[model samples]
Target: MDRRLPVSPATPLIDRFGRQITYLRLSVTDRCDLRCVYCMKARPEFLPKADLLTLEELTLVCDAFISRGVTKIRLTGGEPLVRKDVITVIETLGTRIGPAGLDELCLTTNATQLPKYADRIAAAGIRRVNISLDTLEPDVYRRLTRGGDVNVALTGIAAAKRAGLKVKINAVAMAGVNETHLPGLIAWAHGEGHDVSLIEVMPVGEIGADRSAQFLSLENVRAALARQWSLTDLPDNTGGPARYARIAETGGRLGFISPLTGNFCDTCNRVRVTCTGELYTCLGKSGRIDLRQPLREGGRDALDDALDAAMASKPLGHDFDVSPGAAASVDRDMARTGG
Candidate 1:
């Protein structure tokens, strides 16, 4: 029996499929320091500074969702920590959102700049963080991230942990690429006192990313971990959709987010707000309600009406099929989508 709350017409965010939207992914900036092959095109064109939502505008947009029962907000971007005044933004939103029963205020980052901001983030009321790193080996890391310093991310992770924030690691497990190193990645994260999540490479856009070539199944990853130690499921964490498990022998935890192979759309309860203020009901599909224009026009009623339209048209499930000839592609890449 499903234990989820029943979808209600009175609910401001319940979609047509009876799923109540409670989570929001807010992208602070589309600018990133590193260019990973899977997430960006070579020499990617980033969003200009003027295109981003001001802190005031973002707060107004968030208030609309909070009033409607949205409880979780995760700041994501090409790299959230890179944005100027991010700590100030987090401080503002975190202080305001929590009193209204918002469960979490978190940020996702590549962690290159986290060493500088981790302490400030903790002071700003962000108690949790998600770090994006694909490998532990410095050389492979540099190769995959296109000249990124693995040591810098490691230092940042240490900083995050020392700041008393809970850290979780996200790794994109691409076959024939990082597949063989999954165990090592998990072990490293566990050693660092963090639960590591292996994400299947999503088919978002074509930046020379061959989904069929890089896609790896979570079931296979689960089996491989089983060979090393006892693996058992743990309760799901808020802010992200990864299903976690306990590594019995080592006393570590592992998580798997297989969006392509394991569709969790039936219980999907999240929406995304892009850097440019486009509200996306589904990450893998394209149906956006522009909040930038109305938001800039500055009227409470206009914002409310836009939010209602988005809620009404919220998708039940994405039309993303990994099967050949039936697959769908998102109009924007992961950077633009707040992934």
Candidate 2:
């Protein structure tokens, strides 16, 4: 181990392979209202409350990350709003870290619990909202989610848009599952002034395990859409989160998350901290640096050193491209990992 750290807090913190760590994805809670089959097992159990990082500890960690060049922060959850005093947690973090410190603050939600709290969340300084809508058809939605209410999620999405939040819909494009609804979802969200993204179903964990038949690549879906719509490449950004373009003249835009197709792993700058306080350097790979133990034993400085170590330890890129067999064999559950 080199054990060399970033020399200055002002310099963008570069990892061992020189990847700059700029974004931090924080999972507020592991508890969720719906049991999405992709994210969890049927009737999956929850992480004990005691194991989760308290609001105060989360805030302290965010402060330290921001100081070391983490300019963006996104709060995630098994269902973030389901956490008690959720809005307050948002307010506390937002007030403590603003654009001066943290350039962007956002959240990823399933939208089931969003209708009740969208306005409150927007008012609390959330910059954008990414709602996960796998399918627009109610029957298929229920089938995929196992028991979630489609109407409830739609209502929440409407509330989020009405609240003036930048809204984006995330759909997992699974073959023979929700892929058929892609065109309709694109049309719907475009008409409503929202961006829709089609993500390839990741072969992670136990739910989609051994179910290779369900995987759908971006190329297959793109070829399907290219017949009707002429697509153009939108300008790329440093973060490379969304690869977006307009849908001809319909005023609706589409995005493709081609993680499997092109492997954007080289530029991956994110570090995910699960609700249980484990810091994950890459979403697709495993093994985390434990921050909770350091936080409990040594206060804020220890937390800072942990952040520094994690940023330095991030890999140049994931091994998915070179070792396709290993990518399929990796077995961490997405829900527990806060995907």
Residue pairs with backbone overlap in model 1: none
**Worst ten-residue run, lDDT, model 2?**
1-10
Each model's lDDT comes to 0.81, 0.78
lDDT of 2 by residue, 1-339 (tens): 111222334446678877788888889887888887667778777888988888777776777677678888888888888998767768876774555477778898998877788888888888688899988899999988888889999999999988889888899888888888888888888888988888876665666334456678888998899888888878856254668877885677788887778677777778889888899887767767999988779766677778777876776655543133434434667777776
Q: Candidate 1 lDDT, tens digit per residue, 110-172? A: 888877988888887788888998998888899889899999999999999999999989999
With candidate 1 superimposed using the best TM-score fit, by how many Å does residue 327's alpha carbon deviate from the native?
6.8
How well does each candidate superpose onto the true structure, as a TM-score? 0.93, 0.92
**Top-lDDT structure, candidate number:** 1
